[model samples]
Target: MQRVYISDTNIWIDFGQAGLLDALFELPFTFVSTDIVVDELNNPAPAGLLERGLVVETLAEEAVEQLFTLMAEHGNSSLADVSCYLIAKMQGLPLLTGDGRLRKQAAKDGVQVHGALWLLDQLVAHDIVTKAHAAAALQTMLDAGARLPPVDCAHRLAAWRT
Candidate 1:
């Protein structure tokens, strides 16, 4: 069975902007997000992604309460981000998020967290995309103002440049 991951809005935007939205679903995992996160997406991406196997989950009442609790605790985090963390926690799934605050909080709560670079690495590792393709996409994301870690991006950029 493919592992399911709860994704945050920013990570979705990162993949969408990098033009790897189709490649994202080609990986050997299932990507899911709350409807709240889906609503945060720009028009065409959401519609296209749903057709390509993105799972949209609606939060249950109990989970919604927990989401509120997380939002209050992490005052700087958005409801959508907190929802991602909460859902990942509830489902025991890893979280795909690019928000530093959400990542930090998820770590504190024992939730596994990953960002865009990690997703790119997955694409290459799974043979869903070539090294050169990954490198170009990474550069495109960076060029489009993605706020990924400088050192990690640099390392991947250098290694994948071959």
Candidate 2:
């Protein structure tokens, strides 16, 4: 089975709103988070949504080492995101994120990544939410300061509506 790991921030925010976390349990992937990510979440600022008791946190030394290797390879800024990327890369897992810079960095480093849009797609595909509901939620995300392109949002909305 594959593993799906997330960084400290993005996915938690998006998934919290979309209720994707529940759907994640149905997939054949083990959800994981590193010690660095756990620390970042414990901070008061970002208020990691998953930290509110949704998922388990894994702190393996090997995972930490993999994260450090990816950080060295990509020169990433956030230790949490770097650790998430490294674990996914070394273990052949996919990462869930919504951070633009992190996504770009993960792409450059050949790490598989999924973002908010992907979650929206899954919501629609699984009939978890109606097209209108998904669109409204996505728009809400935009209104709440998510940096999605308007054109891309329109395209996705159209596809979902069809």
Candidate 3:
């Protein structure tokens, strides 16, 4: 079964800035974005995101209330971030995020959360990307100002360098 995820802005930006957004399509996962996230992008209505088949979704009915509740709890987050969480939580789908706070909160609330590192790991595990290529992608993201999870930065960077 294919896993579906509501991807957040940072995750999108990370892949986009790395020029590896197409790599996401190679994975066995479907990604959906919110209107708010689209609006947050530097460009208006990015054609690439749509062309890549990312489903753009809008909050429906009770979802608005749930977004509000998420906002109330995770007040430090943006509307787009809360919206992503709402969609993932409501659909019981995993939330794709690189935001530390959101990841922590989502995990605490039992919402499945995934980050760029996880994405890289999946790509390597599935043989979609070689470890060398994934590591280079990680370096590319870092060079492009992506704030990756710091925990394994040194170790992963070293492994990739080899």
* Number of the top-ranking candidate, with lDDT as the measure: 1
lDDT of 1 by residue, 1-162 (tens): 788999988888877877898899988889898998888878336888788998989998888888878888887888888888888988899999988888888899899999999999999999999999999999998998888999999999999998
Residue-level lDDT tens digits of model 2 in 1-162: 454555446555555554555554444445576656666663222343344333445657776666666566656447777767666666776787765676787787787888778767766776767788777778777776776657888898787667
> Which is better, 1 or 2, measured by lDDT?
1
Task: For each candidate, give its TM-score against the true structure.
Answer: 0.93, 0.69, 0.90
On TM-score, who's better, 1 or 2? 1
Deviation from native of the Cα of residue 13 in model 2, angstroms: 1.1
> What is the C-alpha local distance difference test score of each model?
0.88, 0.64, 0.83
- Candidate 2 has which clashing residue pairs, if any? none
- Tell me how candidate 2 scores on lDDT: 0.64
Error of 1 at 95 (Å): 0.3
lDDT of 3: 0.83
Write model 3 residue lDDT over 34-119, tens digit each, in one string: 98898888732367888988888998877777777777788678779989987887788899998777888899989999888888
Worst 10 residues of 3 by lDDT: 39-48
Pairs that collide, model 1:
none
TM-score of 1: 0.93
